[model samples]
Target: MQVNNDRLTLAVAKAPQIYLAGVIDADAPQRFESMMRSGKIANGSDIYLNASGADLHAGIALGRLFRQGSMVTHLGTQRRQRGAPAKPALCTDACVYAYLGGLYRWAPTGADRIGFPAQMAVDPKASADPDDTSAYLKEMDIDQSALAPLLTAAHADPAWLPADQLIAARIANNGRLPLTATYQVQNGEPYLTLAEVKRGGQHRMSLECRRDGVLFTAYNAVGAEHAKQIVAHGARSFVEVNHAESYPPQQDYATVQDDAVVIARTYPGAQLGSLISATTLGAWVRDRNSMLRYGFEFELGGLDHILRKYYQACWEYAPWQVAKKS
Candidate 1:
């Protein structure tokens, strides 16, 4: 509710933006179902698929293509959602985040190399029927060399190396460059982007970068649009809270660090509620005290109980609506 560009500095103060896309073979659906039932794919795990084997190879090929590129962080396989038994449904969500973060790219063309050893197939009924067969296979052997074209196609023309590799190379090339970029957005508001740079006694690059609003604005816009879409699609969530005083503090408040803002929201039932400081809610409250004040709604028990439970709840139901003048 209180949009504090200042708090964007906290490590966990800001919401993470993600963009995802995937290519899965026909059998991938069945394979994913099997994996879900067998516990091979759990909740919150990052998964990728290629309709054609090409993209699958490209994903794995990243390891070799960016051998010197260490900036790219690889997330491991996460567990599938509790109710969903389909692989595509789960992997799609994961890929969106990876793609938005610029950590992932899928091939425009797919190679239906279903027989590839790296492929994994799920057979939900495999146990019941001994002959039940699934074409899915998990790719274990990643041929980095085979990935060159797929990577190139998935990315913009004159394709850069994989994101992880590119970030690594950028870091290696410029010792002064920051390792990560921070992003933030308020509903119906302009987005903000910030980077952590090394500040020198006489030559502060960070200051220079901030002063160049044009560059920062452009970068922020890119990240902003990407974050917006991700949030709209239910791929990523955001929260606003009071800044914790100590490391891993028990209090539920958002905080800022050098160049990031982190907010946390926990869902009690179906509705997600955020614990925010009064200071943070000042901005939204300044305008109106109505329920529609915040950019989004806190759907705890739906509209029926919104008013009744809102004031009684300890955490603010919708702080974004309470606006305060800077």
Candidate 2:
């Protein structure tokens, strides 16, 4: 696996007194109360992971590569353009708001669920022996004729292919055999054709053997490091509480680049604008898995209020020092 761990760091000026209160355990409460009474708390610099931008970029790149030449009827645009094209009219503010607002409304609740815009099970009636094949084709709407060659190449040598590649090939072939007539010969036999076997007992032996062979090769091709990288990259974004600023500038955050994850830091001065900015920053770093892990530093006046209220209140604090580990 290739791991690129470069990272970028951004520094925001934070309120000094609030930052000081965070470091002194014994004096924290008194200092916090004093600041609150004096109304001296002001806007403080906050650190953000900027992972959303990364995710959006990744989505865009992947879309560009995979969805090229595709047309979106509603958008009145093609995924790619050969030359300058007329700009489509903007969607109405109400329509745009409704569409975007719905996405946000459902995002948190739907995070745990796996969603596919198009998913379909194998049509048992369409297959002669569905049990023997058990292959489910997705994206059946895609023109199979355009995808046949890729599938044929992939099926010719499954050993070198990844599961995603295999799935893509299967989808491209419209759920049929992914081979051409040219490469069907193996040991003077037609390897491309499905062979007839006795039903039940004797058939079970051949099926078991074939399954074992597949499992063996699949396991052989998958490396432990590669699997680890995949899991790291796929980890869901987490909100880190209390351990804010523990991250070592860009270096510590960069450690997760291979994993495609990021940590967003929240502090006493956090507001809606800062939060939104941090979230957007975390989302922008794309080399990693396109997820942001948010970190919130706990202190007085930083919690309990709505996002907009919190932002308004936090802007009154003085610049403070961010604690660092010696």
Candidate 3:
């Protein structure tokens, strides 16, 4: 076993396989290309074993290739510190995306599964846009419905999707077929870009999270009608929280680039001259998932083009609560 701290590396065995573990860093693209050229991974001959679960700021383009490198088997702890106990296999952040590279991918249930390993941890700070994953699922020829369950399962800890679910989702198209002699993992769908109108300088947003809950305020000079328009547009576009009546969102402008989150909106109300949105990210709102509140604001009429100023408070998450690690 070879230990290469934190970065992606291959554990060469006495066979024709390369075992990979650790974070896929920014340099992973070049490294992966080198390996593919050097015959470390091949279409029909080599199988890649992955245990990495973090991205370490890796780019999405690099992640695409790393995922397509080979058919991957989620191995738990084949290589570890001396005399250490076996660990649960985890695939978080971009590592999970890379796992999609397989002509055939297999994940063992860590403790409860028969035939395959029992449980694999898949928790990570993930994208908020379901479409981000839905697009990829389309390219992989997998059902888009699989994404919701995967995200929900990976909500707090490592996860294992039932093989039955994968088959039904068509992610396991060939039914646990590990070696596909002539298969090729295709490129995933490109992220979408939509029309955007920035807030210009008319609106100002602020956030403060307390023990009771999080408070968000947006002061807009766009008037009451403007606030209503914002809410109406977001209701049709942004991913609604629970019901449109209870938790209203105003973010529907753009998809975040990475783990970057959008910090906007709340229970926005029109005041004397400004529009304010407030909500509690706690049980006070009777919502357990209310710990983090976010959304976006689109200023009306030429906010971006007329004034030639564009500023939208998108991609906002409480930094103190998150630790991006392996």
- Among the numbered candidates, top TM-score falls to 3
Per-candidate TM equals 0.18, 0.16, 0.36
Q: What TM-score does model 2 achieve against the real structure? A: 0.16
Candidate 1 vs 3: which has more TM-score: 3
lDDT, candidate 3, 48-95, per-residue tens: 334443442342444355446533334344545768865655555555
RMSD of 1: 21.9
Clashes of each: 63, 38, 20
Model 2 stretches astray by more than 4 angstroms: 1-262, 266-280, 284-307, 313-326
**Candidate 3: residue 144 lDDT (0-100):** 47
Q: Cα deviation of 236 in candidate 1 (Å)?
A: 35
* Model 3 lDDT at residue 132: 53
> Considering every candidate listed, which one attains the maximal lDDT?
3
Of 2 and 3, the candidate ahead on lDDT is 3
Candidate 1 or 2, higher lDDT?
1
RMSD of 3: 21.3
Model 3 TM-score on a 0 to 1 scale: 0.36
For candidate 1, write residues 6-111 as lDDT tens digits: 3332244232211122453334335444544565433322223322223442333322222222122222222247675433222222222222221222221122
lDDT of 2 by residue, 218-292 (tens): 011123454345435544333221322222122222123232222333233212233322321111112354554
Kindly indicate the candidate among 1 and 2 with the higher TM-score: 1
